[model samples]
Target: QFDRKSQEYRALKRYWKLIQQDSRKLSDKRFYRPMFRMHLTNKEILEKLLSYSDELRQHYELYQFLLFHFQEKNSDHFFSLIEQEIATVNPIFQTVFKTFLKDKDKVLNAMELPYSNAKLEATNNLIKV
Candidate 1:
């Protein structure tokens, strides 16, 4: 029985790792909408898995904001949104907000740049070959 339980645990761990990989892929434009739709359908499961954490919910909101509305012109609003999401009660969220505040100028400068790192990733792949 112990051996069988251990095997099941290992299988679950492997499955979770695969899910993480697929979740990362959702950042790609082609996968974003479909994965987001699936996530809405599985909202209850996701909420439970995220442990009903308010910090995680705030982070998810920020992520969605960036994913959909990111542009040079919106940089000010982005930082403002980050400021609004900073929670006084959560040390982790507070630290993250502090870091962002500290590097605000640098981040704003990068946002104004015309180029994106998406193409740079392709160049990196070519260099690795």
Candidate 2:
């Protein structure tokens, strides 16, 4: 049995968020440090957690692979690989896979585009204010 309130558990939760973070937009490194001072690196902590469950480790690996493809803007490959791999792994991912397929063009474009309208939108909002 695992104690959810344990320091290790808190560190594991942070680890989940860290792995998905885009390096370009990563926050202060100290913000992601473990709940308590520890000699172990984040990688070491993550490896320890992953060792606890094979199923969890498999899901994490799949997630990492998909994220890598998406981040690298391999839109076509991401779509196909996600459908073939992610959909079969779990019901939650099956839902996500279906949603991605439904908006395939938009999703792919977002991934391929080097820029976003976020700044323009912010400026527009400021003018209207």
lDDT of each: 0.54, 0.72
Model 2 lDDT, residue 77, Cα: 81
Compose the digit string of candidate 1's lDDT tens values, residues 1-129: 125446434433333333233233343222322322443323333443344346555555566675444443588777777787676436775787788789988777777776668888999999999
Task: Quote each prediction's TM-score.
Answer: 0.46, 0.69
lDDT (Cα, tens digit) per residue for candidate 2, span 1-129:
458987556656767765555434544333334454555654555666777677777877777777888888888788878877864587887788888899998997899778799999999999999
The global Cα lDDT (0 to 1) of model 2 is: 0.72
Supply candidate 1's per-residue lDDT for 62: 62
Q: What's every prediction's RMSD, in angstroms? A: 8.1, 4.2
What TM-score does prediction 1 earn? 0.46
TM-score of 2: 0.69
